[model samples]
Target: MLAETARPTAAPPTPPRLGFLRGWDTAIIAAVLVSILVASLTVEGFASPRNTGFLLIDMIPILLLALPMTLIILTGEIDLSVASIAGFISCLFGALWSSGLPLETIIPLCLLLGAVSGAVNGFLVSVVGLPSLAVTIGTLALYRGLAFVVLGDQAVTSFPRAITTALQAKIGATGIPVWIIPVLLLALVFGVVLHFTGFGRSLFAIGYSEDAARFAGITVARTKFWLFVASGAIAALVGIWWTLRYGSARGDNATGLELSVIAAVLLGGVSIFGGKGNLPGVIAGVALLAILRNALQLASVPEDTLSMLTGGLLIAAVVAPNAIVWGRTLRRKPHTT
Candidate 1:
């Protein structure tokens, strides 16, 4: 009698929902596909495997630098000197090669220099307590100037064909360089670290607010220091790679590259306010950029026009979310009496 007195009903199940592409990642991916289709249809030889190899080759440096840049931005910081660091590494590489040092020896040395350069920035921003933007801007000029001092307008093109050939070689019929695989590998590592670990969660917390992260015992300064060092080291590595891939080393190599990296990172849906980003989105954003630039170049678009387009994309990235929020506010009506 007691058990039959009352029968309890179970709660209804929650509705199935779509979470993929809940942000700009899907848009970027779609844009990439569309650009590829258009380029293939209109630009003669645009869809050729060789052209794709060149495209992926050109993207390696930018894509490599963008990885560390994503982490730095996630912590609400910036590194404007990435390109400069790369240039400096390239210049130093040429100088060292001219001095008869082995390429193998030069590679590790240049990487060391990169780490040190980044450590300097980290010290200034994390320990000295300077604003990241200002510090990086100052170092940008400093590193670039050092590169000029090292190379003095000279270009070194005496690299061995073996290395260059290896770098330039195609991977099977995929038209992707041997180096392009590294980008995917790094992205996978970064994605895992940022999405599936406490360290990555800490980055978000720091980006949300350093003060809060500190309260949570997250070691904000130490994390930032490492991030900058990683950025600098990766940048330096990119510089070296760029030199080898192009068969030339110059102080001004990769000039203005930082802008493109920053633009792509922001465009990937990593909010300017920090604590809002994902590696998949960043990859999509970078791919979109590469695709657009490649397509436009095939169509003989002016360099200025490309710059304008990049600028427009960046502006939209910054504005679109805010505009959406504003619209939602406006559309909401007050409760009636």
Candidate 2:
């Protein structure tokens, strides 16, 4: 007898899930809104378009540097020398300008110097198998010292008018600085590269587990080496832009900004341990910090106080996720015996 087969029951469908805007992104959004509100309330001209233009101008350098720094950190490595490298490039541009090097040559030279510096860092970390922290920290002083040696307390004020004006000008009378365009452009490119490319996946994998990435047939060293180079090149580009905008290039420009760049990268949800983060978060983090600083400045806060506040914010951003995870584990009741 042909027995009627029982109809198989279908598995229950998974519940609809909230998408990628997780805790970190949420925090970034909240921070942005709060900073704007606070600025509006606390300072008379804080919300004015002119003040915003200045803020945007100031943010461009940091934002641009943070892009590749985000990627490098996502691969579980750090580039502490970005600021120093930028300083060096700024001085290089200035020195060359004074020496009558054509602007074209000066531009490429700045980028080339950055690439060489980054390549050295990459070799140290990838080939020599040194710790990134140690290597970059050493390069930090080395690069900055090189800057001082090149410029030696001097400033360069003469640059091509075209370059300087492009950096300093407002965009279409909107009070949005022209420099903001490049930051936004770079952010878009970073987002695309990280989210839509095989190389990006490889980077994230390496950050998560270096051995695993190697076993999976990824060229760990080469990828990481290139990341540093990219960081250096990008930093140089930002440096040129910054020097142009400011109309002066000195060896000491952007000193102590390594902390802010790293802070912004970390605040964007890229873990110190690596294997987590994205371009969007990094961009938001940059914006949040810029807005916060601008707001605080408008309130006439002391520079030391602002530094303290930024440090605290960095610490909290790094700590909050761990605390939340711990709390979740603690509150989760044991299954019934």
Candidate 3:
């Protein structure tokens, strides 16, 4: 006698819970609020639309680079060569156009060059199994040196007037500069990718543990390689913007900018060692730095003091979180009887 089997019911799937904020995001948000308050209080002309427009315009490149910088850090890699890549691409675009290459041709070629640089860095790190720190540091020098080799002491100033005017022009209605449009667009795109996409989740997983992530079917090497490529491409785009805005390209332009880029990324909340951070935090970090710089300039603060302030902020950003993490770990230990 075959008895009818009892019907089985499946348990309902659990809803996802809200995740708590990471250290970097919290710090950046707080810093941003404080910066706004301080700027408003200290600088008489600080809250004007013109100053705000200038601040936003100046922030575009730094904010743009910080987007990919956040991703790279999240995936547990670093690219110290970004500033150099920017300089090199700037030189390449300028040299090509100066030598009579069409703007359309030079632009695509510059982007391709940046992508190749990133691919090489990715290969060195992933295929050759070199540490990112060592590889990027070496490439940083090599790329910047190549920039010098390409342009030497010469600068390129002659560019299409239309391109320059379009990029640097301010909008009449809001008084916001056109240069800031790219920054806003890229930031929105990256924010969506990081927070709302499966790829973003994969990045966090890979950042946590590459071997474990691979076991879970994530493409660690490929994703990381593409990450570097994207970073290179973005850096190149930043170079193009700089050339258009300044109407010139020099091998030394944006030199030592890597520090600020990293500083902005780290300050935004992504851990230096990897595995935690988000775009909102990074945007806040960028805003905070930009506002501080803008306000200080208005206050007539010395440039040297500003440099020192930034250095101190970077050090504190790196050190404070580690100290807190360690403190919590120690506190959780049970006392010996």
Best by lDDT: 1
Residue 105, candidate 3: C-alpha displacement in angstroms? 1.2
lDDT for model 2 comes to 0.81
> Where does model 2 exceed 4 Å of error?
1-19, 160-162, 333-337
Error of 1 at 88 (Å): 0.4
Which portions of model 1 show Cα errors greater than 4 Å?
Answer: 1-20, 332-337
Clashes of 1: 0
The better candidate by TM-score, 2 or 3, is: 2
Higher-lDDT candidate of 2 and 3: 2
Candidate 2 local Cα displacement, residue 29, angstroms: 1.3
| Residues 238-263, model 1: lDDT tens digits | 99988998889998999989988888
Candidate achieving higher lDDT, 1 or 2: 1
Tell me each candidate's TM-score: 0.91, 0.91, 0.90
lDDT, candidate 2, 85-135, per-residue tens: 999999988999899988888899899989998999999988998888899
Ranking by lDDT: 1, 2, 3
Q: Would you list the C-alpha lDDT of every candidate in the order shown?
A: 0.83, 0.81, 0.80
Worst 10 residues of 1 by lDDT: 1-10
Q: Provide the lDDT at 181 for model 3.
A: 74
